[model samples]
Target: MPSSSVPSSPSWHTRVELPSDVPAVHELTVAAFGRPTEAELLGRLRTDAGWIDALSVVVTLATDTGSPVGHVVLTRAFIDDVPALAMGPVSVHPDHQRSGAGSAAVRASLDAARAMGERYVFLLGHPSYYPRFGFGRASAHGVTLTVDAPDEAWMALSLTPAEHPLPSGTARWAAAFAMP
Candidate 1:
């Protein structure tokens, strides 16, 4: 894990989350967040139809290892009947928090979304932390979620600026999100 002032590709490098990485990823997720909540949500996402392979990305200290030092998951969600992505629970082991691994995984996740023809990604996270990856307030882009959150904390990124613009509507996260 490497840390830089601005998020970079990370010296550790990133890869698509594989079945083999699940256990380590779960452990890391729990350790990073100090709770089983995120890991449980990931499990729910995995068994749900919203789990897109490309959306689950990870970063590791070495390519040969199945253990992920960090992870970022994006899942199928809908915005006004158009398909979109919901990003969250981006986790980095507590030991690697400041290391660039988390940022690297996030970058990889966004890149994968664009490559998959996804147009929009929404997230509820730190207002100050996510902008480096080009995220801005979701409301500003006309994207809304079905829950309450601070304006700045709910953010979005438009993958296809010219062809796909995020719309103003409720974002229905996957079943795993369990948003009431």
Candidate 2:
């Protein structure tokens, strides 16, 4: 069964992805990125040591028989040896793009991570979009990535900022990410 629903728009609700959601999530991810890369990454992550079953989240339409319309995952990563999370492969079905499903899923996943006592999250994503979730440039706080990405695209969020400050070190992603 899906986990508890998170705050969402009236049209949809967010919850942890059930095992049965695999196929739909793959399709939604491919649709969102217009490529198989991220979808393939999702599959690899699922089998990798980084997979966190409870952190895979989905957004289901309230009026559409509850099929998932969006998804996001927070998986194990590290800053030096300090454990953290890597958020990625966020996806919303093409039809649901720009309709808030993506944001809802991401927010819910972050909330779930916080509830699980996770302290920090890092991602390589749209600087403009992630800042809305309290993400700031990772490099600004001394976090670096082995992968070569635009500086502004690398971001981090300290979920418990007052209690746990962001650590300074190179991000070490899951092996599936192929980050050097």
Candidate 3:
């Protein structure tokens, strides 16, 4: 595992999550959060209409040839009536935390989203941690959330800003989010 401040090594292999990877990803999510809430959310999202199989990413140690130690998901969300994506339930095995595995998974997911023509992504995450991935205040782009969270924790990223700027309006996460 790489430290948060450290860059992920080139040895970290990133790829889309496969059906065979589901169990490992679930266990990793549970281990990372020390709870099943996030994992449960993932389970629900998997069968939901918002699920995008290509946007689920995992990271493994190229050297070890083991199961993925990191995972991330970008599911269907919306800004106002416009379609968008929501990044969440990012997980890295506890044993692999602080290693660059988490970052690699995140980067891979975002890249996959962009490649698939997604333009906007919104999330509630650590302000300091997510900014490194080009996320900024969602409020700055007129994005709002009904969920109870600090102003700074709500962030947005424009995957293709030059072509399509970040949209504005209340973010509508997947039903599984159950945000009020």
Candidate 4:
């Protein structure tokens, strides 16, 4: 169920940066997730064929500390062979959770996607969290996942309602995501 309370914004610096920031971004992901797997996945996605240049975003504290407090990434995915985006593994430093770092990253990334003319986006994420960004059950729009997931956990968002609209089909990640 969606929370009755809106999430409070984090008090930190948030902006998008260049590929030169990839290392710091990876480190932030590892620290936030407490695992190397997501870091590895992000690395692979950087070189994947489906990667999109403008969709990656980084969020950091406002103090100019030169360290990222959170990160969010989106890459090209497909629904029924139609172009879309996939948001994943957004991470915020454990100490910074509820500070709005993660939400800032997500909001930035989605804004970037919309600016780039993307229509749809899919994500496997916290049921309670993503809806604040306009995400709804993928099945509600005829989208699904190859791997099993609860209906509430797999979600989709439409950035351009008039053009691509919402499509129904399996969400296919880039080849990088298929690697071990």
Candidate 5:
């Protein structure tokens, strides 16, 4: 049931990760990145205060297999002391990469954040792939990360732009992501 096949506009059901999801998420993170770096990072992040229960979302399926096919995380980060979010380690099982699973998980996480009145979300990820969710160059808004990232790869999205503009300055991610 771990097939990559999904509907054209998949009716993906997403929910917060349960304790049981840890193993599958770790697996998907490793499979998606082809490494354990992000998986280790995720484990550390989970124990940190930045971790928000509602923001660790997974894409649930109708199949009897009942394992999540995708996962995305939104941890508390900051912009010059102002609260924001940092999304990352987003991954869809390689078997489901292009099947809309990733997008569904991300959208669900973002929607959950918005419902919580979160305003700004930032991430260091693919420039081309994230924009569809309303992300744009963080540097364009004068935002930067602690480490050097290509201008275009570091991006932010405003879930409540009219109210809270992404405060400009260094984006302070959770301590787990501190420069090595």
Candidate 6:
């Protein structure tokens, strides 16, 4: 899979896991971002009392010796008061760039969201990277952001068009994400 490659060495395995792996997930995020801001954000989100456990996905090495190399988190957000999922802060360790670890993490998170019956997901990220996951410009669906951001950077994905469909309104992230 494109999401499980090892860019330089071509010798790592990426697999998804449960919340018990938070510490390793944090380490991977720190290593990937070279800072604690993203990690802190994730920490705050996890304890916010509103986090949806089933939507959090972590990608780790298949072997016991392999440490977590990438992380992706999806949490409850809103579109004009309509419940939705927000994808963000996806991280792949510097050494693992182009290895597909980040892609795998995203794919896993999306799958989890679908299974949990979530219909819409929003993200403010690279205009390029997220399209492969069926994400498109949120503006196309009437979705907007409260804070200033590039229009192309804000995207959304709908898992069930028949039911909830896409929402049109301002995106509202959790309070933890709202903190500076």
The C-alpha lDDT values of all candidates are: 0.86, 0.92, 0.90, 0.84, 0.89, 0.80
Per-residue alpha-carbon lDDT of candidate 3 for residues 1-180, written as tens digits (9 for 90 to 100): 875776645478898889999999999999999999999999999988899999998899988656899999999999989999999989999888887888888999998998888899999998889999999999999999987789999999999888888888999998888886
RMSD of each: 4.5, 6.8, 4.4, 5.6, 4.4, 4.9
Show model 2 residue runs off by greater than 4 Å: 1-10
Candidate 1 segments whose C-alpha is farther than 4 A from its true place: 1-10
Arrange candidates by lDDT, descending. Answer: 2, 3, 5, 1, 4, 6
**Taking the tens digit of each residue's C-alpha lDDT, what string does model 5 give over 102-158?**
888999999999999899999999998999999999998998777878998999988
Runs of candidate 3 with Cα error greater than 4 angstroms are 1-10
Name the best candidate (by lDDT).
Answer: 2
Candidate 4 local lDDT, 1-180, one digit each (tens): 886987755467667757678888887889888999999999898899988777777887776646787888899999869888889879887878888888889989998888887888999999999999999899988897888788999899998776666988878888888921
Clashes of 2: 0
Top candidate (TM-score): 2
Poorest 10 consecutive residues of model 5 by lDDT?
Answer: 60-69
Candidate 6 residues 7-101, lDDT tens each? 55344444444656788888878988889999999899888755887767666655543467787888888888898988877988787777777
Clashing residue pairs, backbone N/CA/C < 3 A, model 2:
none
Where model 4 places Cα greater than 4 Å from the true spot, the runs are: 1-10, 162-164
lDDT of 2 by residue, 68-149 (tens): 9899999999999999999998999888888888888999999999999999999999988999999999999999998789
Q: Residues 49-159, candidate 1: write the lDDT tens digits.
A: 899887899898765456689999999988879888889789999988987888888988999898888888888999999999988998986777778899989988888
Q: Lowest lDDT 10-mer window, candidate 6? A: 8-17
List candidate 6 stretches off by more than 4 Å.
1-20, 162-164
Q: Please tell me which model should have the higher TM-score, number 5 or number 6.
A: 5
Residue 94 of model 3, lDDT score = 89
Considering TM-score, which of the candidate structures 4 and 6 is the better prediction for this target? 4
